[model samples]
Target: MKEQLIEKFENDMKKRSYFLRLLLVIDQFFNVLFWNGSQDETISSHVGRRIKSGKANRFEKLLCKFLSKLESEHCKKSLGE
Candidate 1:
């Protein structure tokens, strides 16, 4: 069963080009970090300090929430939805 599953995955992957796979991997990471609430973490520690001390935009906060939700949904799907 495990070998069959692996073979199926390999077969599916063979249909995709290397560039496409790279793009997908990049996009998935971007979605999780950019859309997810991790932007604050991405900003250098110093910049993050400034953003925290100073006021952050309302839209930025909204974006954090949006990204968090998307991340959650993606996780749910990956868990075998």
Candidate 2:
């Protein structure tokens, strides 16, 4: 019974790790799509549409905030701030 519990815990951990990695990949994909150029308005409009249409998930909205923060930090670094 102890060994079975240990095995179950290990499986749960592995599942969580896999989910985290998937989220990271998704975030990276959106970051590239929305931040690869100077088309900020385009990206914003697209996201707004997604939100209005109920096509965006909570995770995607959170990812938008994360990507925006990353972009701000990058800009600050570039400007030597």
Q: TM-score for all predictions?
A: 0.39, 0.28
Deviation in angstroms for 19 in model 1? 0.6
List lDDT for all candidates, in order.
0.49, 0.53
Clashing pairs in 1: 35-67
Decoy 2 TM-score against native:
0.28
Residues 3-48, model 2: lDDT tens digits: 9999987986787787775664564466457655232223444454
Residue-by-residue lDDT tens digits, candidate 1, 1-81:
999999977986998888976765665556457555342233222223334566545654454446558675332233211
Q: Give the number of colliding residue pairs in candidate 2.
A: 0
Error of 1 at 39 (Å): 16
Candidate 2 Cα lDDT to native: 0.53
Clashes of 1: 1
Best by lDDT: 2
Q: Enumerate clash totals for all models, in the order shown.
A: 1, 0
Candidates' RMSD to native = 10.2, 15.0
lDDT of 2 at 31: 45
